[model samples]
Each structure stands twice: as structure tokens, then as C-alpha cells.
Target chain A: MRSHARIGFVLLLTPLVLWLGLLIVIPHIDMLLISLRERISFGVYETSTAQYQKALTEPLYLRTFWRTAVMSVLATGITLLIAFPVAYYIAKMAKGRLQQVLFMFCLIPFYVSELVRTFGWMILLRETGIVSNLLQWTGLADQPVEMLYNDAAMMVGLVYTSMLFMVVPLVTTLESLDDSVIEAGYDLGGGGFSVLREIIIPHAMPGIVSGCIVVFMLSLGNYLTPTMLGGKDSLWFTEMIYNQFIVRSNWELGAAFGFMLLVLSSVIVWGMLRLTGRTLQETMG
Target chain B: MIPTIPQSRSFRLVYGGYVLLFFLYLALPLTVVAVFAFNDSQFPSLPWQGFTWNWFFGDSDPQIGVFHERGILRAVGTSAIVAGCVAMLSVAVGMTNAFLFNRYEFRGKGALYVLMLLPLVIPGIVLGISILIASSTLANGVWDVAQLDIQALRPGLLLVVLGQFSFITTIATLVITARLQKFDRTLEDAALNLGATRLTAVRTITIPFLMPAMIGAVVVAFLMSFENFNTTLMLVGSDAPLTIAMFDRLKEGSTPLLNAVSLLLMLGSSLLALLVILFQRR
Candidate 1:
């Protein structure tokens, strides 16, 4: 009976194992193998880091790689800055029904696909877009200014896309702090900034780190937003990877670019977690 | 200054300004998407010529509404089918995997749990690349070993479903596992002690308890599958999902017809989420 139960448990676990093991693990291993080798011919191949060397040494690839890293970090920082006050309001200030409605308000658009959401931004920011028209109408600008296809536009899209990931964690951590703690700090003659520094921020550090980590990782590896929002000159690294595979049909080169992104993200994520003293398990949710 | 003081003029001003600005930031773009669906302009952006329902319904030159747009209905149909399959399958796999977690004490379970969740953190683009490369490479070997149709092993709807299922199943499992954590398993043991078979106990007691979470998982999986773009873009064959369709239209110079499509999707997702929120409240 015990053996039969063990068999059943094994059976129960098989699908999960088969899925993660087959689709995720095996494929990534294959990709790793592909990255290590150079394509010699149509059917022949080699084992070398030539692809990695190309990715590392090529100026365009290297420049875009660093640019993606820097942009993602900047986007994450901007998202955190914008999200904190909103999260604080929702967590601390709102009443019962108001809180629920506010939370839902933030969530409803998230249900809209990122493609649609980004498209909405496109509509609003394009040369003849709403913002430009409004600017022209109000005499703020002489003619239609191309508000889309710029770094600021890219930053806007990144911040907009990553807002919820930051807000959710911040709210979760902020909600747990007692109201009286802030009140006590204020009563003890702490100014607003000091209270924020000594009481609120320290209390919310875990949430802040988790939100930043998630947002940074997301924006770093993101392809669609940068492409659509940034237009032809976006030069996002993921686009480079896409070009390597789909455009250039260089699978080995694409694989190498992909792992480099993986390493960059992983190392930063690790360092952030260490600095913040948060565990992988805690930050993930 | 106190962060919260209704009496303080500066505090009220700051609070009101912050809330209004942030809410507008969140709501304005989506509002534009919905509003421009009726814009008479040929271009989807601004300079709204006049209001027209033609974008939603008119079928004529320069105004082939979303309904009449070529390949759109088909893309929507494909998205629905794929989402439906992904939802059902991810839930089934998730529940089964949750059983593995909830009903047993085993070695390496912790490690395996982490492994299961690794997909969640890995970027969708990387995940897409890995699956596309590995599956194409292994297709012949898999076909030979299983003696299945070559098409089954190829990149198609099946591959898309599998790629989505990998991460989504992990999510479903996590949801159900959270439910199971608070579960009193003694109820199952009690049922067995009372001479109920294992299957009977699970069917009557465990399943009923899990039904809510299972439903939530199914809803989440469906929505995620529907909206998924990055991973699906890489894995997609000749056929395109709505997202891919929209991206294509962007390249082709789109019309307000795309706005109609976005509005419809937004309405559907909002309605579904409303139902879920209401269901949970009840």
C-alpha cells in the first residue's frame, strides 16, 4: 500500500517534472550548448565561444547591451519614485471602499495587454497625437511636435508598463506598518522628510527592493515596449538578439546575446537582494 | 508637516495634487484608446476629425472597421482557442502538481519547487528563444521515439500552448498550493479512517475546497495566455495572435480600427475581472 501510494505521488509529479524539465531546462541547456559553438556549415557545427566573442567585441552589440542595462535601471528608479506616493496613499490614506476601488483602478488596465496599452501611448504621443494637438491648440507649440519616438517616450512607456509591479509590492509592505508609528515620529518632532527617512522608508525597504528588482529585471529583458515606443532608432538589446535570430538567422549569435542578458540581469538581481537582505522567496511574490 | 492632516491647507493640496496627477497618468492613455475608437480620423492618433462609429461597424473604403478587417477575426479566434486550451491544461497540471506538494513529504521537494518557479523569473524573450531552438532541434528525435506525427513535434499552436503552459502551470500550482497550505489534511485522513477510499475523499472533500482557487487559476491563466506577446511572438508560426496582428498593423500604418479592437479587449477583460471580484466578494 505504501509503495502504491509512492507510485501515485510519482505519477502526480510527472507532469510538472516533464514540463519544467523538458520545456525549460532541456531547452535552456540546448541553448547554452548552441551559444558555446560556431555554425560551421548547413549541417556541420563546432564547439567554441566565437559567438560570445562576437557579442562581446562588436561595438553595436556592446553599446546596446550597456544602454539596455542603464535604461532599465533608470526606468526602475523612475517607476519606484512615481509608485511610492501612490502606494502610500492607497495603503495608508484610503478608506475601505475607496481603497478597494483605487486598487482595482490600478489593476484594470493591467488586464489590457501590454501591446494595446503601448498602442494607446502611441496614439496619445504620436506627431498628430493627442498631446501634440493639445499643445498646438493651447499655443504651447508652433506646430505638431513629434512627441513619440524619443528616449523620453521610451522612458514613459517603461515607467507605465512597470508601474503595477512596483506599486503592488510597495502597498503590501506599507500596509503592514502601524499608523501610530508615523504619528509617533511626527509627535517626536520629526519633519516630513525625516519621518520618511527614519520611519517610513526603513519600514518599506523590503517592498522597495522587491519592487525595484522585479521592475529592473522586467524592463531590462523587455523587447516590445522599447521597440514600439522608441521607433526605428530604439536599439534595444533584445532587438539585437531578435535580429540575430530572425533577421540574421544566426541562432548561435542570438543564443550568446540572450545568455549575456541573463547573466547581466541575474548578477544585478543577486547584488540587489544581497544589499537589501531579502531572500529569493520573499522578493518573488 | 504631518503626512495626513485634513485641516492643513498645504497637506490637503499636496495630497489632492498627487492623487489627481497619478490617477490621470494611469487612466488617460486607456481613456484615449477607448475614446479614439470612434474618431473619424483615418490615423489612429489625434486631430479627431469627428465622431464616427464606422471604426466599429462601417464596412467601406477607408473605413473597414475592426469587424471587417482582414485576418482580425481569425486572429481573435486563434487567441481564444489558445487561451482556452492553456487555461484548462494549466489548471489541470497545476492541480496535479499541487497534489504532489500538498499530499506528500519528500526529499528535494524544496529544490523542485524552486525549479518549477524558475520560468516565472526568466524573461519571456529568453524563454521563447530556448523553446524555439530546442524544440526545432529535438523534433526529429522526438518524432522517431514516440512515432507520432511530425507536425505534433513542430512549432505551431501545440508549441505555443506548451511554452505558455510551462510558466502558467507553475502559477496555477502556486495558487492552489497556497490554498492547500491552509488546508487541514486531517480531513482527508479522517475520511480515510471512516473507510472512504482515497479517491472518494479527494473528490468530495479536497476538490470542493480547492474549487475557488482552481477557478481563480483558470481565469488568470486564460487572461495571461490571451495577452501574452513576447514569448508567443517567437513561438508563433505563420498565424498571429491579436498582439502580433496589432504589431503588424503598426508597421503597415494603422487606422482607428485598431482602437476598436483595443476597446473591445479592454471591455472583455474588465467585465471578466469585475465578475471575479464580485465572485470573490460573495
Candidate 2:
């Protein structure tokens, strides 16, 4: 190879490789060591799996583990149900400028920070919030109904936060589908339900799976939303990890819990890929 | 859509209402955030006392508008600094990877690409802790080997920037390389055949085509860095970004001033989205 080209290659490649190595690889390996060992004193330690054992055996941790898993799955399902019609309308039914405008309507709000979005929910859901105030003003109720600080509120927040991710992918796949196929099905004496079930659903399958994976992963790892919306009672697994690191300052346990969360997300993602048969490359976009 | 077929009445009513409500759900929360920023009441929610610009321009004894709040302004400045640096660094690094790995033949190139993306797939909370673990260990290793204090090496804004850059660079790479895949190699070959150097050909032909994606990537990286909370919360020291600053204020029993900040941020983000929409199409 010519010297200039070789030099150009090294200069180009070194930063990325060094960055991934130093930050991504080295840290996680260090995290493994931290999780495996108990700190004896400042800057001293012995290797043990006690943190993982405690995480597995403790009721709070275990309950939180299941709760996070179930909640994330439920949130993913809810987001899918809400996102599908929106994606369909934008991708299949809506025409020209209207399509882009409506889609942007969905996309713009998400451009706001998740913190801002969650706070918006709090403002609307708190006992003295607009919903309660409106309810009382119209004599629908005598008292302000506290809507925030509950599981259902948490779900609403999660669904709102994650709806955009699902919509984009579904639109991508749905747009690729031929309109004539659906028209043909309708001409063959098929009802709307049969046409949709037989044609549209199958065609949008990859998009659906991809959307679910992204939504699931996001909801599972989310900390700020549940903590803010669900109050202190929120049992999100990420919160458990946050408590370990921030509140308790237990690095060992935090590392262990972080590792556990990683494992859970990875396993679920792998299982989803197997079921959906999507390559990692296709889904990454 | 083909726009040839018409829908049934029931179909139109149900799906139309559903879509309208869905948009309402998407938009209502943010509208509330914006509306409350101008609310005269101390608290953001209920019975509108009257409209006031206090949250934006006016200042009272205790709570000043976000524009007048020094602390919030400082955090925004800090956030801008961090995000600007992250955008440049991630784009530079992402461009490098896209050209070298995607365009050239190299052993372990596939594996390296996957490794770069591992950060993207993993929960950012986990990535943040891992950075904390790795950096502290590196500090200790420095202490042991060189007998140096290296207090500057501790977790701070630099660490936070690096931690965010680690994955955001991956996102940048994905965007640029997706553009790179559609590159026409014949142009380079033609340029080389005409006695132009490989570097010059790349600089002229390839890089110009990549301008759109690179700009998009920089925009995305900047936004990601700006709004980032999960990973950043772990690596930060005493210095707080806007998200952390706002969260701290909320946790301390916030007032309408918080809504003002939200309105400003939402406006900034909406403007960015508008830029992307105008420039790039799905």
C-alpha cells in the first residue's frame, strides 16, 4: 500500500477503535470485576459473587425484577396498539402533505426531552392538575381526583415517551407495501377485517417486531419516567439500580444490578430476534 | 397512499377519531407545559389566576423567569458546550469509521463494527455505570504505576462528554455509513484514472455526497447529548446539565419557572426538528 493511504487509514480508524476500547470495553470488564468482588476497604477487595446472590435472593430485588419485565412488556404492547393506527394512517391512508404533517405532529413532541414530557404528565395528572380541575368545575366530581403517582399513570407516561420509536419503524415497513394488493383483496368480496388480517398485518410484520423491540428495550431501561410519575412506590428495576448507586452508594450492588438489567434486555432482545427473524443490521436502523 | 379508494363511513369515523385522539395524546402534555409557562398561578396546574409573563421575562422576589435565572442559564450554557463538543467529535469519529471500515477491506472490521454498536444497544444506564467503574479504575491504575495524583482525571464534565460520545458516535456512524453504502465507487476510480490522488478524489467526490448525512448526524448527536440524562447522571460531578438541574428543581418542589424552561427547550427542539424535516425526507 502507498504510504499516504496507509497513514490516512490509521488516522481515520484509530479514534473510533481507541474510543470503543477505552470506554465501552474496558469499563464493562471493570464492571464485571466490581460486581464479582466485595470491597473490603477503600481501594481493596476480594472476589465473590455475593452481590448477584443477594440480588437473586432478595424479595424486593426479585419483585422489582419481575415488575420491570412485566411493565416493560405491557408498555410495549400498549405502545404498539396506539402506534399502529397512527403509522397506518400516515403510511397508507394519508396523502401527500397531510402525511408528512401528521407524522411531524407525532415527531415534534418527542423532540422535547423525556424529562419535559414526564413533567407535562405530572402537571396534567397531579391532584390539582387540569383534569381534576376540569372535573370539579363541571360538577362531574366534588373533589380533585389524584391521577398521578400510580401504575396506570406510569404506563401512560411510558407509552407517550415510547410511541414515536414504534411509529417510525411501522411506517417504514408499511410504506413499502403495494396499495393494489389491499384493493385486490377488497374486490374479491373480502371485508375490511379480512383484508387487513390477510394482507396488511403480514406485510407490516417486520416493522411491528422492530418497533416492539425498540419500545421494549426503552421502557425496560427507563428510570426517570417511572420514578417521576409513579412516585416513591415505583418499583422499576432501573430505579433499584439507581438506588444502589445514588442513594445507597453501593457500587458493588449497583454494578451487579446493572449487569442483571443488561442480561435481561439482551436475552429478551435475542428471543425477539429469533421469533421475528430480523437481522441485527436491519433492526439497528 | 394511492388516493383512489374511498373509506366506509364507520371506518372513517372510528379511525379518524382514534388518530385525532392519538395526536391529542402526543401533543396535549407539551401544550400543557407551554400553557403553564405563562400561567399566573404559582403552581403550574389549575384555575388560571391570570396570564403573566413572570415565568418568561418578569422577576419576583423568590422565583424569576428562566431567562433571568442565572443558575438555569449557566446550566444551558454548560449543556451547549458539552453538546457542541460531542457533535463535532462524534461526527469526526463516525466519518472516519464509515470511510475506513465500510469502504475498505480490513480483518476484524465486521467485529469492530458490531463492538462499536454494542454501546447503542445496551441500556444507557448500564453504560454510564460502566464508565464510572472504568474511569475510577484507570485513575487508580495511574496512581499505582506513576505515583501521580491525577485529580483532573476524576469523573466530571469531561467524563460525561466522553461517556455520551461513546454511544452517540455509534449513532453518528450508523447515519453516515448508511449514506456511504450508496456511494458510487466509479467516480473514485475515474478520478484516480485522471491522475487525481485518492485523497483528493475522496475529499472532492465522496465527502460532498456525504455532507447531508454528516450534517444530520451532527444534529442528532447534538440533540442526544443535550437531552441525555440516564448516562450523564452517572458520570457527572458537582456540575449539572439542564436536565439534571431541572430534575433537581422538580425534586425540590418546583414552581412555574420550571415550565418556562421546558417551554424554551421544547421550542429549541421543535426548531431543530423542523430543520431536519425541511432538509431530509423519509
DockQ of each: 0.67, 0.71
lDDT of each: 0.86, 0.88
- Candidate 2 lDDT (Cα, whole model)? 0.88
Candidate 2 Cα RMSD (Å): 1.9
Candidate achieving the largest lDDT:
2
Assess candidate 1 and give its TM-score to the true structure. Answer: 0.96
Local accuracy of candidate 2 as per-residue lDDT tens digits, A15-126: 9879988988888999999999998888778999999999999998998998999999999998998898889999988988999889778788668899999999999998
After TM-score superposition, the amount by which residue A111's alpha carbon in candidate 1 deviates from its true location, in angstroms, is 0.3
How well does candidate 1 match the true structure, expressed as C-alpha RMSD? 2.1
Clashing pairs for model 1 are: none
Per-residue error for A187 in candidate 2, Å, reads 3.5
Q: Residues B1-282, candidate 2, lDDT per residue (tens digit)?
A: 235567677878888899998888888899999998988877897778789899988777665888889999999998999999999999999999888877667788777766877787789899989998888888888989999877655768998899899899989999999999999899989999999988899899999989889989989999999999999988888889999899999987768999999999988987887787678764
Q: Give the alpha carbon lDDT tens digit for every residue of B1-282 in model 1.
A: 234632477777888799879999999889998998998988877656898999878899888887887789899998999999999999998998888987788899878877877777788888888998888778756766886667755667888888888788878988898898888989999999999998999899999998888888989999999999878877888778788888898768778888899999999998888777777666
